[model samples]
Target: MLEELEDLFESSTIRPTFSYVHIILALYIFEKHPEGIGRYRLKENLLIGSGTARSLINKLSEIVDFIEVSGNNKRRGHVLTDKGLRFLKMLKKKIPLLEEGNTKALEEIIIQDKKLNAYICLVKNSADKLNSGIEQRDAAIKVNGSGATCLIFDGNDLKYPKSPNIQNNQVKIGYDLQKYFKLKATEHNTELDKDDVIIVGLGDTSERARLATLNSALTLIE
Candidate 1:
């Protein structure tokens, strides 16, 4: 799945430093800001340089035609095409939940760096693919995140993949997850499955945190 997504950015005429994370983020940005966003604002939201942004926009338009220009000149911006909206819909079906989280509440029970921002996402039915969670952590780190913690919700409790001692803080973590995360999931009309997995991404900035969170969650998908 990861390699398939990465292929979308491939271009014979131009070499792009961007990855699938950037593409997913652009789709998300288009969805959130339907009013249209200029290149500068898009670059700011993506945290990428001018060249990378140009190349990325080109790929999004020329390669996949997911986005089209809106307005004109300085007012020019991008908006998701019907194809892009449908693609985003498919992505959301796989990853139903992705949002920023306040992990400070679980600091006492979960090991978290208070200085970093935290993002939480729920990937439906991906728990079976989770190992010791090292892969998720590595995925986050690849995107400049501090780290990621993967947890699976069985019928009863949320537990670490291979940590027997997880019961020590299992109750507390579950309570906090529901209080801070699950409520948001409910609002989206997406009920999390008992066997779904949750990933918490910790990063220096909010954008990095979100990007890392999605990247880690993607690993659990297939």
Candidate 2:
């Protein structure tokens, strides 16, 4: 399969950057249509430039075992090998660990730096007592298409949105992240279970939501 993929890449023209986003997106495209999807279709669905699509396909050839088969009208398309399926499953578990490590590293910088610490202080009071674990406490941040954000701790049907901006400033549907963070702490000294995962939403406004999410995340750190 790898040799076959190399031959295909050698025959193709477009090339893209090394992006996990593209790889994941391609996997998603392949998953949605089990029969297989064409290169043109991937480019169209992903809306990345031609070079990016080529690069993405090239990278996938290296990491995932995929193959070309007859798509609609006998056009060439791709599908996941069994190896690819297992790789994605392994990635699902490891991605969160990677994110946590990075988030913690950033948290350290925020706490140790004077300016960052002061910035966090500004909104800490606003996000008090706002956290409630979803059915499961182990979820990483999930956002949905309607702009809803949640850390689902229960059996609750949390629609994890495909992509969430999550920029401490953007507001999805109507989630009030700033106020949600303030809800975590009733009094300054109180401590909740370190395992607790709080969920926030995008509210009616952006500035307020951003402030709240940023503050709420800080409160969690504190």
Candidate 3:
């Protein structure tokens, strides 16, 4: 029993590097907008700050040929190359599994407004279908399966309860969302965060799209 306890403690002690989340988000963003030119807009839409979003783009540029910046630096954006797509396809084969600590972190960052519980439900349900073979017909279906819910508060329609808030000096929540959904960064969009919250139907369309692409890519691998 002592040995088992030691092993458990050792396993729990392993902290994930920020690069893991960054790479995952980069892949997702690349997949959704292979063109890459509209990354700035994508960042805002996804509720990610300009700095964090740019860093992810820069890191991805190193690994794959898909990322390209505009010439003047006046208008910055990214475009995915064939190689990038292939890389994302490869990543699709390995589904990401979040530990209990990660889940707790997610809970803390998410705004616990009126829609908090619904968002949790959506996440839980959608996670169930992560490994399911069926193609998701729509965002609503996907959210239901993932056990997450959307909430419209302060005029911002948060697709999932997970906010892009920073915690424990970790990567932003948007980056984590990209990993959980297994898509490139620009795929998902964000509205405004508001106070008058209401539990809306599941509506993570972009996230669903990313998952679908990942699923399709995984199938091609085997």
Give the candidate number with the greatest TM-score: 1
Cα lDDT tens digits, model 3, 1-222, are 112112211224443222233344455665665444555765653445676566556545653354666443526566665666665555543323211112333453434332322122111113222322233223334323232223222232233333346233222235454344322111323222232111122223433323322322222122
> Residue by residue across 1-222, what tens digits does model 1's lDDT show?
444466565668766888777888788888887877777887887778998888888778777788888754337688888988988898888787778877675464347658888888888888778877899999999988989988777766677677655645444255765555567678777876787887888889988889898889878765
Model 2 regions more than 4 Å off: 1-18, 62-74, 92-222
What lDDT does the true structure give each of the candidates? 0.78, 0.37, 0.36
Better by lDDT, candidate 3 or 1: 1
Candidate RMSDs in order? 2.8, 15.6, 17.0
For model 3, state the Cα shift of residue 154 in Å. 42
Measured against the true structure, the TM-scores of the candidates, in listed sequence, are 0.87, 0.37, 0.34
Name the regions of candidate 1 deviating beyond 4 angstroms.
1-7, 71-74, 108-110, 164-172
Best prediction by lDDT: 1
Model 3 earns a TM-score of 0.34
- Give candidate 2's whole-model lDDT: 0.37
